[model samples]
Target: MSKKFVLIYGDAFVDYIAEDQSNSRFTKFLGGATVNVAAGVARLGAASSFITVTGENETSEFVRNELAEEGVDLSFSQIVPEKEVSGVYVHLLENNERHFERYVDVTPDIQVDFSAIKNEIIHETSVFHFCSGTLFHPIALGTTRKIVENMKKSNVLISFDANIRPLRWSSEESCRETISSFFNMVDILKLTEEELFFLTETTSIEDGIKSMQQYNIEALLITIGAEGTYAVLHGEVVHVPVEKVIPVDTTGAGDAFVAGILSKIYLEGHPSTKEDWIRYIAFSNRLGGICATKPGALSAMPRLKDLQ
Candidate 1:
């Protein structure tokens, strides 16, 4: 049997991507990286599942329906009618990293009964994917920690995206401190080269990989944008080059990579060993490269057939 790939996302939304033009068109897709990963996995015809909490409003309902459409297992997601959905403000630039501002007014505390999360998500999860953006919020921070502690017993392969943001954290030092601490707990750490630099204040990719290896992490995926990707596993480094495509918008490229990597691992790696993980990183990088060539993150996500 293949190990299940379970992902957790902070459910919120926005027409985040605006631009510096009068005739700018804003395309609204699922905003959160975790949520985008879920959709990306589903697009590849894999069993991608997500756990999240949303407010009891139209926004929450829309997100639920989107998850359903993607066929992601939503057994762990919550709809707290007391809160409002999270949101983002994206400033789009033609070929630059999209700028962002987030909103979480009425953000409420969330608690998921471990019994329920395990029964529904853990027993079946081969790998657990986590995000850093959601941790910036105090309301959901402790809840995140509890989920991590509760889920450890299952021996699921842990993957954390140190998706760091200076604007969101209390201070640069504080964010880096928390991120470094958390990455130690997870098995595989995925993030862009920029994130690694920000979190560790290190400039070299080799040094960054070495830094993460201290955590006893099995693998590290460093997304290098249009230049492609690099990975280090069990002290051996491998590189996957990207295929250049005229990019419309690189918004979901990284999320697509996460999906592709997890899907390949879940499908090809029944045993889910350290060895299998090394191979998964290579294939995952290819998936990300494929995403960069296309437009929207969800739409840009490649099918399994594309890999062949």
Candidate 2:
């Protein structure tokens, strides 16, 4: 069966990339974890859809148009009040690393109504992508739960990224609670080395993976930056080496890695062996490595041709 990749319930951001110390020029790009992953999946020749909220302003219009051009569905995405702007963040680039200073408070103001496409699209998905940051917003949190419940009933494969932004949550304990609660519901999880230690409250990566074994997760992908990626598959762990690259910006590399894994699974089917898992991680690492070479997240994402 042909499968669809759907990214559910996340925010959209208009990122302003600063030119230099002169602060004379800036470029805007479509961003957000879900948006980056959605675009990455589509560029890899998969059927991708983004289920999120946006206002009817020019920035939102740019977002809608760009995703549509990339072949991501916006049918289920809702429009909020015109006065309410979509989230905006300033991307500060220094020494090939990126930092963000957000301007908007992403609260309950732009929560999506999943009911809009629940009956029509939820069951048709093969992979449902989730991010933990959405849980910080009251209404989006509830909406995320509703979507997950439906996905459970439909037996859709759920992939989650903690994507933890500490500033967004009320407290570290609360963040852990919200993220930990969804562990059992997800089929695949992607986490950075720091997030692994933070969420599991374990000092080492091995213990962190062991801590999540009680959950129903089938696979866990841990990205250790320059050290490459590790995947826990069928009780065995496999490490894949990353391609060396001179990075221009490393903003959404992890999100692109998530997209590569999902894209490979959608095309090749779920892996049954450690070797299969290794192959998938290698492809994912390549996509991520390529994304880092470019400046913006969404724009920097690789296409199928680029991967070739």
What are the RMSD figures for all models against the true structure?
2.9, 2.1
lDDT of each: 0.69, 0.80
What is the per-residue lDDT of model 1 for residues 112-150, given as tens digits with 9 covering 90 to 100?
A: 333345565667787777778767666556666766665
Give the TM-score comparing model 1 with the true structure, all chains together: 0.87
Best by TM-score: 2
| Model 1 ranges with Cα > 4 A deviation | 1-5, 19-25, 102-104, 108-120, 270-279, 305-308
Q: Which consecutive 10 residues in model 1 have the weakest lDDT in total?
A: 14-23
> Compared with the true structure, what per-residue lDDT tens digits does model 2 show for residues 247-295?
7778789988998988887788878878888888998998899998887
- Candidate number achieving the greatest lDDT relative to the actual structure: 2
